[model samples]
Target: MSSSKNMSGGILACENALQRLLEGKPVLSVHVGLDVSKITASIVSLEAGFDRGYLKKSRRAHLPILAKIESVRAEAGKGSNSSSAKKVQRLEDKVLLLEKELAMVRTQRDRVLTQNLQLWERVRELELAERQNKTRQVRLHH
Candidate 1:
């Protein structure tokens, strides 16, 4: 399934679980092989809570499940923060490498341009010498 659809479904499932907890209902565990579907749903819930500050406001309700959710959220938050920091660092390194490559290319271009100008100057000098030599030959023949 697409990530957005999967995330929305997971959020809905988590909301149902939370409502069941609030009403003191027994939560049914949906087992799919070794994976606990409840945890997947809870993770989505935690992401939304952490991102939107919903869990912070819900803390005033004093529910047992909220405490458990808060602890899990704290752990997840730490892991995510560290992973995101690593990704940012990697991207910065790539940018630095690319910038260095660009500088090298620019330097090479400047050197080639200078060489081209020098070659053109030599061609002009050769043409002028040829013209002078032809004039001297014509004078000798006369």
Candidate 2:
């Protein structure tokens, strides 16, 4: 009985910690005696918050709970029985769209960078030619 009580208490503490995290509050791993990384990984697996890239770039300690709540609401809209399946499909579609968009943006960035490099090379060539012309004129006059 005592063991069960302790287990229940631990569970309650975990639940409370999760609640606080969801509320955009800071939760220390030491306070909850839980691995924050594991908890965040589970949240990421559930597709809560933004994409992995955004999360890594932002270096946020916890996932944004608002996104999770919105996702849950969107999933709930399609009935409970098929919600998970539909949500997975929807998320997959979103990933595909984002991937395509990312590819296009990368192509544009590459093109722009190439153009910039070419412009700098042209500028350097022009400067060198002008300097050579000035040197030639100076020698001819002398």
Candidate 3:
């Protein structure tokens, strides 16, 4: 009957709702109609870009908790064989993409290194030729 007891109950309900949201469950509450899809969109928008807009700035405090939720999801996948297989496939695809990028970068680095060495060799040869010409000129003068 007391106001303090009612306030405590309200706080407990909010905490339960948050836990359900973090677990990727649909929260069906009459007072708060929180859609799971809307929350997912909000989280994705906050993390998808380089710019920190108003939504991102306001949601910045939730990033750590969301990251923990992701870890929990990954752990949960292990319990389901099909979900674990899907997760593995996604990870493998990412690894393949990174490997391709790494190979391209290595090829570019090799090309640049070869060009640098060739330029240095040409400079050395030119310097040798210049020294030889100076020597001949000095002998002729003498």
Candidate 4:
């Protein structure tokens, strides 16, 4: 009785990256990491000067589902200073940490549901046994 719900998260950048990669252009460097939920993933786009308009060649990037987050550093001069870069880095780290927490919670919830189902099954078994015992007792008295 475990039905699944279908959903999709659109990533135009990823689609574009894959297309470019397939067209013989190496996938512009990006740190793609699977969200802790493992349900969806995000790829941090890097490499400036990417011509998003160039869509003549469409191809799949074939990037793996769980790509490693190599390194996330603000592009040089993108930030006002190194402190800003550090701040960005910290934010990304926090996001990744939160994702991990979310995944953990999901796993715990699944485990709890399974345990509940088992308990309900046990209750049903006990109820059936009680009913059977009552029938036996009545037959003996008769």
Q: Where does candidate 3 have its weakest 10-residue lDDT segment?
A: 48-57
Q: Give TM-scores for every candidate, taking all chains together and pairing residue i with residue i.
A: 0.45, 0.44, 0.48, 0.41
| 52-126 per-residue lDDT for model 1 (tens digits) | 333333543324445655665566567777778989999999999999999999999999999999999999999
Stronger candidate by lDDT (3 vs 4): 3
How does residue 30 of candidate 3 score in lDDT? 28
Every candidate's CA RMSD = 12.0, 15.3, 13.1, 20.1
Displacement of the residue 93 alpha carbon in candidate 4, Å? 0.4
Best prediction by TM-score: 3
The clash tally of candidate 2 reads 0
Residue 25 CA displacement from its true place in model 4, Å? 54
lDDT tens digits, residue span 37-119, model 4: 22112222331123433222232331331232121122223334765788899999999999999999999999999999999
Candidate with more favorable, higher TM-score: 1 or 4: 1
How far residue 53's Cα lies from its native spot in candidate 3, in Å, is: 37
Where does candidate 3 stray beyond 4 Å? 1-80
Give per-residue lDDT, candidate 4, residue 127.
100
Residue ranges of candidate 2 with Cα displaced over 4 Å: 1-81
Q: Best candidate per lDDT, number?
A: 1
Poorest 10 consecutive residues by lDDT, candidate 2? 48-57
Residue 34's lDDT in candidate 1: 17
Give model 3 RMSD, 1 decimal.
Answer: 13.1
- Whose TM-score is higher: candidate 3's or candidate 4's? 3
